[model samples]
Target: MKAALWYGKKDIRVEEIEEPKVIKGNVKIKVKWCGICGSDLHEYLGGPIFIPVGQPHPLTGNVAPVVLGHEFSGEVVEIGEGVTNIKVGDRVTVEPIVACGKCPACKEGKYNLCSLLGFHGLCGSGGGFAEYTVFAEDYVHKIPDSMSYEQAALIEPIAVAIHSIRMANFNTGDTAIVLGSGPIGLATIKCLKAAGASLVIVLQRKSIRQEYAKRAGADHVLDPNEVNIAEEVKKLTGGLGVNTAFETTGAKIGFDIGIDSLKYGGTMVITSIWEGEMNFNPNVLVFSEKKIVGTLAYRHEFPATIAQMSDGRIKSDGYITKKIALDDIVEEGFGTLTGPEKKKHVKILVTPDKSLLSD
Candidate 1:
């Protein structure tokens, strides 16, 4: 089996390794497609953020040089002992979250907030950027037969967008402004419209990303570099600002723009896993009586997300911008996604099976 491993910052290598086997309470999957995620890019560019270097992850007990992908889907090739619900040949995608059940958050059904929070790919148990990977049965979800392998691979990120919308206080007629138009940002735009948000405004500067934002259902797209974001948002919202705002850029300026673009008493959801500190005025939230909330990974939103995509409420057709074989993952996949031409792509899916590679 060939797998991509994260050794350190900007150090992901594709090497041949022993194929993973099914174990009690888990299943082995013949991976079909896996998407390179923003978090993965963060680890590759400026990491050790979640890739545990100094010591083993408290839950998985795995450290650096771990297998590096989670946004993926595949066919169940083998089922482990004690696993009954999942059968061989079923199409599925793993939730990828590794949470400690003993935590207070988990006890209350909020596993994403568990004290010992970890991820399958980042913290390791082996990941999907390989020909075969094993997953705990409890974390895998079956997909409808109508969904394609490429779309199934995106369930994890789409789940993120759905979960964020479910966490907010917006309703059918409400409006929102999303800062940034990265993968997660674009996913958020589609989810917002599907959830019935009256206006879906996006702030993005890159020409490629702006086009994606529109395709993702954004009603209006603006570039902060060319205009005043807050002012333009106010004008669009009749000077009251939007009912809610989502900051997915993970940049300090995104925080500023998100907070400034909300109406008094409006809510703002921070969905990005930032790598650094951000400076902002506390008085802004105090004077307006507005609130800020944070969302981690998905909770009980996977089923709904799958349904939305299966029925066409949430679109995934144009999200995948490129695909490459495992052999070219570094140069054609991650390298292209993280280099100067980064904005040219929306999502890149890698296939470990060479037979599926396109010429």
Candidate 2:
């Protein structure tokens, strides 16, 4: 089977490797479509964020140069012993999180906060970038027949957005501002609208992304470069800021926009996986009586998100901007996503089955 593995910073190789076989309590999926996530770009540019290097990941027990995709969906080809709910020929999408079932967080039904949290694809245990990969049956979810393979691949990201919104103290009819308009940021907009947010304002500088932000259900897309983000947000809210702010940019400026543009006592949800340390003053939160909530991966959000997408409560369309074969992953997938033309894309889906590319 051909798989794309991350060697190090800016190095992703597409090479032939032994196909993964289903193990006990696992299911093997034939790759259909896998979205190249922003986290994958982070590892490719400034690595080891979630990818293990010096020491093995506590969960998967594997190190760097492992398979490198997770936001994916596929068809089940085989199921290992003891896997009951899932069977062969089922269309499924993986939650992609690996947690110790006995951990405190897991026992408390907050496994996304597991002490030694790791991801299946990023940490090890094979990945969706290959033609075939095996994952525990628990994380493999069946998708409804109404969902296409491309949309099924987007469930992971949409689930992330739903989780973040569910974590915030945001209420229906409350206004919110989202900093950054990447795939995750755009997904946040859709989730916020679906959650009944009254007004959705976006702060994005990229022209194309600004357009995409509006398409994602943002009521007003403002360029931070032209006008002050905090000022404009206040104007829109009649001297008060948005009730909630979503920080999805992971940049220092995004942090500032997320906090400064929120109404007093508002809640800001940090959803981005940052690359480096950020400087902050505790006084900002103290003076305004505002609070911040941090959300990680989705926990039990897959099924609900799938149902929402299936029933049209949450629209999932037009996010896929590019598709490429595994052989062209390095240049067409990673490079293009991070290169000069990066802003032209919203989500890029990769497939190990080259035949699908021709389709």
lDDT values, one for every candidate? 0.90, 0.92
Provide TM-scores for the models. Answer: 0.98, 0.98
lDDT of 2 by residue, 152-174 (tens): 99999999999999899678999
- 1-359: candidate 1 lDDT, tens digit per residue: 89999999888899988999789999999999999999999898889887888898999888888999999999999999999899999999999988888989999999999999988888978888989999889889999999999999999999998888878867998999999898999999989988899998999995888988888899999998899989999999999999989989999888889999999999999999888887778899999998899998899888898999999999897899888998888899889987888998988999988787654
Give the Å error, residue 21, model 1.
2.0
Looking at candidate 1, the ten consecutive residues that score lowest on lDDT are 350-359
| Residue 266, model 2, lDDT | 93
Q: How many backbone clashes does candidate 1 have?
A: 0
> Model 2 off-target regions past 4 Å?
none
Return the TM-score for candidate 1, rounded to 2 decimals.
Answer: 0.98
User: For candidate 2, what is the lDDT?
Assistant: 0.92
